[model samples]
Target: MKIRRWQFAAIILTIIWLFVRGVPLDPQVIFGELLLGFILAIFVTWGFRRMYEGQTNLSHGARVLPYALVYVGTFLRELIVGNVDVAYRVLWPSMPIEPVTVYMPLRVERPTAITTIANSISLTPGTLSMDYDDEANALYVHTINGRDPASIVAPIRRWEDLAIVIFGEEADPSDPAPDIQIGGDIDGE
Candidate 1:
């Protein structure tokens, strides 16, 4: 009777994909695209069913739009800043690059949130997410400039803060922010 969250997500994603693919707005073309989208939505929903299980219901209700907008805006800004920083380091040979591996603790408990944050980090230009330790809830990140572990993790913490709200994760007031441990210089210095 009622469509599940995964099914809804699949349907929306399919429609977006079709639109991006330049499906025309003519009645006949629209009908055909809708039919195709319906078929693909079914398969996509089935394939990703497990992933939706146990996920936070944050995306289901009224707060979804605002949270999505905030997350997207913050991510875009960070992505741009990271790109420019990397570009500057590359273009200016005199720029000091203190590459270091940082162990960043995780506050979000949801698997989806954790994975999203990790992927976001890797997507940024100056940082690479090397690995995640589930047991420790820590992420190993390598950054071009990591002289101050806190500075390196500050943006990630901001991302995590937004993700907590977007993903409906409970923030623990008593739990201190994750500590960043610099492992060593990337150049073997």
Candidate 2:
């Protein structure tokens, strides 16, 4: 039987993950460890294929490598900025916490992409992904400073744009701007 594209991708990813996890390639390495890695790779690949269903076309050749690098760099930058922002709020005597929940409609349709975006939002400081309205295709995010919804959403939109390309999802030209609704303040009545 021939290996599918996703399977190949999975194998590559698995090998990379193993290397990153510090699995040595020395000849003295145990055979069992290698066997385990292969098994784990197969399992992960199978699960990915099942989860993505018809959306596992990550065979974009070398084009995807740069996008992947960009995504990681962008994510790291956001993470650092978020940490610093949260640290400032924590250290400041007068905590300026004007919390508000905003409903931002989803543009990326792929489940993995949507999940990644949600996780990224939650990972960022001052923002918490509370709920995902699948029916409405929206995400409810609670932010420490929501006075400017556009500003809050701008970065997320940037991430989404990158994710669209990274995940190989088609960008719908007709797609309207995300419907952002400023929910009531989360501080108090």
lDDT of each: 0.80, 0.76
Clashes of 1: 0
Q: Candidate 1: misplaced stretches above 4 Å?
A: 22-35, 47-59, 172-175, 184-189
Q: Give residue 166's lDDT in candidate 1 (0 to 100).
A: 68
User: Per-residue lDDT tens digits of candidate 1, residues 1-189?
Assistant: 345678777778778868776987788988888888888887987898886664334335456578668777888998999999989998998999988888887889898889999999999998999998888888989989967777678778888887787677888524578666777532244
The sequence of per-residue lDDT tens digits that candidate 2 reaches over residues 67-183 is: 668777887888898798789989994978788888888789888899998998999888989998988888889888866778778778877877787777887524566667887
Every model's Cα RMSD, please? Answer: 4.0, 4.5
Quantify how close model 2 is to the true structure by its C-alpha RMSD in Å: 4.5
lDDT of 2 at 91: 97
The superposed Cα distance between candidate 1 and the true structure at residue 23, in angstroms, equals 5.0
Counted clashes in each candidate structure: 0, 0
